[model samples]
Target: GKQITHNLKSRASEFIFYALALDESTDMAGTAQLAIFIKGVDVHKIKKKTETLAALYPLKDTTKLQDLLEAVT
Candidate 1:
């Protein structure tokens, strides 16, 4: 978490806007997924950052993900 925060803070200038999309099934055995969209930075960079961050710290809750989005933007 700290590492991710640090990386984001260091590259804060590259980001302009942040948006998060969350989806969850209505069934009891459904699953959830989150998609983060960031503007200003190049799409490739955003993709790389999101992929790396997802691998390092997989977020399970929307609140934590939102917190991260807020921090970066």
Candidate 2:
């Protein structure tokens, strides 16, 4: 986990510009799951790349917009 995180950080640092995408969904157990993705253009190769930044699970009964913001920050 630590190594993967380090690699992600290293790759993200080389991005010329990046965009973030967030998706919220419910699982079979009715738990809210938030998926975060990063889409970036490589500075050196000018190639576009997309990667999963994180998957956040809210511990609350309902997953509110504020809850998602708080989990990310």
Candidate 3:
């Protein structure tokens, strides 16, 4: 168990990738519709976008998966 724990700790800083894309349209105001495209993204970006989206768009549970799935579908 101790060895496994140590190994996991060593890999904790491993880099990961993710993807986020948002396509939207708006008129009149400069910031009406927003489209975000995140390809080969990372965890840091995910957390940042999530917080911003939660504050701006108000998504329940403050989770990014739901939003990501919505974009895919």
Worst 10 residues of 1 by lDDT: 50-59
Would you list the C-alpha lDDT of every candidate in the order shown? 0.40, 0.67, 0.37
Error of 2 at 38 (Å): 0.4
Question: What is the TM-score of each predicted model, taking all chains together?
Answer: 0.28, 0.65, 0.22
Query: What lDDT tens digits, residue by residue, belong to model 1 across residues 11-73?
Result: 454554443333322233432333333334444465544321221232354545474454334
Residue 4, candidate 2: C-alpha displacement in angstroms: 13
List residue ranges in candidate 1 displaced over 4 A: 15-37, 41-56, 59-73
- Give the worst 10-residue stretch by lDDT in candidate 2: 50-59
Error of model 2, residue 11, in angstroms: 5.0
Candidate order (lDDT)? 2, 1, 3
lDDT of 1 at 37: 31
**Per-model RMSD to reference:** 7.7, 4.1, 14.6
lDDT of 1 at 22: 34
Candidate 2: where are CA atoms >4 Å away?
1-11, 51-53
By the TM-score metric, which is better: model 1 or model 2? 2
